[model samples]
Target chain A: MTATAPQALATLPLADDALILSHRLGEWAGHAPVLEEEMALANIALDLLGQARALYAGLAEVLGGEDEIAFLREERAFRNCQLVEQPNGDFAHTMVRQLFFSAYQQPLYARLSPVLPLAAKAASETAYHRDHAEQWTLRLGDGTEESHARTQRAADALWRYTGELFQPVEGLDVAWQELAEEWHADIRDVFGRAGLTVPEGPSEGAWSAGAGRQGLHTEPFGRLLAEMQHLHRSHPGATW
Target chain B: MVTGSAPAGRHPREASLTQLAGSVPDPELPVITLAELGVLRRVAEPEPGHVRVELTPTYTGCPAIEAMAADIERVLREEGGAERVEVRTVLSPPWSSDDISEEGRRKLAEHGVAPPRAGARRAGPVLVGLSPTRHTHPAQAPAPEPVRCPNCGSAATELLSRFSSTACKALRRCTDCREPFDHFKEV
Candidate 1:
């Protein structure tokens, strides 16, 4: 079968997560504080891009479409949540974003290795990303007074978004439910290790930004699409 | 984990799968096979003639995994005499530039992409009593002697962007040929 069928991909959740995070990371491509850091962030972005493309390609195969998910859908068709879709703020904000997301991601990936192939791959890369982010967090959080204060501010600003990372989508099967439970416990543990205090804020209900798994999204997605799709949309099937 | 191997001509299928799967050259960097590159970490034959090969990416975002997986399936099916090949991505051991084999590095260099020197010192100076400009110094430093221009055989070249078409390379322009080329960024 070609890439045009409409079958549901098994790894859509992971694919969506990768897609959103890659977009967020790509925003830092040229704007990092240091050149080496720039390279490192770009490398991480590429990793996320790799995961996104593979997952999307797999999704396309299941969905049966000539266009990959990035190219084919309206904004609402995307399944990624708002936290990853939020604009990356300053370096501190970016690090906080990295810290918060990887806290959830690192453990999720660790638990997934024996059970799933894609999860195993995500877990490995995320382990590196987690270490990278955690190091930065401690450096910024416990270092100089200014950096510590700023990191604290960043944490406060971004803490509101953390709840949604573990919030399960409605359609998960039993295996996914079990995985989500493990993900919750594992993520909380990592946060505790990072010296981050888990907020007891109200849970951001499903699709407050809309149901991402079911392809309901918010306003920001349109702008993201325009930039992401500009080349492919402008060139019409052009190959690099 | 094989049992009952009395037949004189029979080899454990897991061993055969591992051997075959490991022998497949990395599509992007061919000097190393998946086994040598650490891309293929393990293989299992849970059922007869159906092999499951586990792989890891060389970089967090290496695009070659898909191609590698396809290639792994193709190579294993042919060599192992298997009806089915299941290639799985194992991400627990994240790939680092360090993972590339010495042979792989040589091949990459021959391919005009400079490979990372083993345990090479980082270009950046550490914090404390270091000039902020220290980080800026290396960008202007002269390209090393063995730096062959991918566009021409001239070693006289100036550094451009450290990141080029991909993160693995840098942009450089040769003075002798006056041609800009991508130098596989030495990790």
Candidate 2:
């Protein structure tokens, strides 16, 4: 709407990542154990959707008025990180993913706030999201043996992917490094309180990960894209 | 319409204030003006040379609410509609997408965001179809109907993500054109 010409794949993953997660969270909407949870996840889903729209819209502008890029781009063309792509295995797994991602995101968004316009605009909602995840983690982790065991398994399963959060993208490194340094202490403190440990760094210490943030995606991405775009691709302009 | 003349002693300020206050659009959907959203409940002269506008959100937890209130205050103050702008949040009678103007829907579609659907008439329980993961609940009347994409106008749109970047829409992609657009998720 603001009318900036669309840029290259520069704004690729951030918005797309949010968009994908929004879709995932939506999967849990009415299915959550309780009505309150159902509403909460649905609320979370809506928030992510909004974030995706703004990012996609911005990306479209940057790409020189290519509105199709937002809707019509192929699967490999999407750049969302893999952590979000993993299935929501169970409530515990869902909480773990949220905890892991929210922990990283709180600081990431906080640091990115000064630089990214939309990040600043989205600060409060992100803060609320972080708070919600932390609250749930503490509830599930500190509860019964089953809850605790599940939470632990969830954490362990997701910890492997935590390293990817630090592996910087091309234009993202400068901001990512600064953010890591700035928020390292805070991230650790929060994790400590929730009985969650800061995941150990990757021994390999490589950042390649093969161009996800640059529109090059994993194999599953194509399937996800196919399902996501099926309706649009099939019917074309068929309206209600 | 009283022509530009103020009642003998007053300045013609409230008129200018209303015009300026009217310029601020709904924060979430920027196309239709807030006035049309029924968000600007009133512009009144509670005191001499002072005008107040009562404002409310379309949804209780809509993220843009705080910003919208601030925007209202800022815009009104800038345009001199009121020396002090008071934004009141009224939640008793919650807002419905039906409140969105016809023009508002057009604007949203033009911007590539689908308009809110007419949600009530065709369904069983209101909440059933909006969410598909609920197996515990029995089958209900099919979801009113699939929502069409505004971009390519495809009714074959699939509910891709129940959550979008904000908390009020779902990410639905048109199956026909593979174009993903935002659907104002029915609450």
lDDT of 1 by residue, A1-240 (tens): 112222255456666777778877878878888764676577778877777765665556556543557776667667776667767778777887787777676665555555444555566567556656765666666567787677767767666666566555443322434555665565466456546555455445552333555565556767888888788788887886
lDDT of 1 at A57: 58
Q: Over the stretch A52-116, how does candidate 2's per-residue lDDT look in tens digits?
A: 76566556655533335545777666777777766788998997787666666656554555545
Q: Which ten residues in a row have the lowest lDDT in candidate 2 chain B?
A: B121-130
The TM-score between candidate 2 and the true structure equals 0.56
True contacts kept of 2: 0.06
DockQ of predictions, in order shown: 0.17, 0.06
